[model samples]
Target: MAKYEALGLIETFGLVFVLEAADAMCKAADVELIGYANVASGYISVLVQGDVGACKTAVEAGVAAVKAMEGGNLYSSIVIPRPHQDLGKIIKRYSITNLVTE
Candidate 1:
């Protein structure tokens, strides 16, 4: 199983409840949700890690669930075939010190 990572920007009518719901949905998909980081304006950013298929499914399901709960506006961007070595190289080149921290 190849590891994959996804960066999603989800917007909800209600921030708190929607964020919690999104978290639950991600957990159900067996995704390692890295939690949310409030970004520009009122959007919340979420990072997820899992198998490629699982990650894709999680992002889709999570977005759907959140939308169902309170009308969701989600943008999901996934990186496929993300091997650890490739990720490490990206981290090194980009000087991404907070690779796993945030």
Candidate 2:
């Protein structure tokens, strides 16, 4: 079994909105913040990992938090359960493991 059963992502336009989402996600579920990525043009993607149900709940909470922001601009959001191990290669730089070791 994988260490984490699911991965959640939330993309938004404002840093403050994303931070709000991240805070909500962590508080609403037993998830780990894997880190975030800036995709330029004021877009950022926040990542979290946990069990399937927790990931889904966390993503929902994050989306709601962003929507609650006065001028929040949410780009997209997703929850991937049982993702392929190889997917890590693509997002390795944003993983918490990378942050810890570096």
**Best model per lDDT:** 2
Residue 25 lDDT in model 1?
53
Residue-by-residue lDDT tens digits, candidate 1, 15-73: 66446555765776776654554556666555556666666676666666765654455
Model 1: which residue pairs collide? 67-72
lDDT of 2 by residue, 6-91 (tens): 99999999799889999999999999999898889999999999999999999999999999888888999999999999888767
C-alpha RMSD for every candidate:
5.4, 1.8
Candidate lDDT (C-alpha), each: 0.53, 0.91
Model 1 lDDT-worst window of ten: 88-97
Regions of candidate 1 where Cα sits further than 4 Å from its true position: 1-14, 17-21, 75-102
For model 1, what is the alpha-carbon lDDT of residue 42? 67
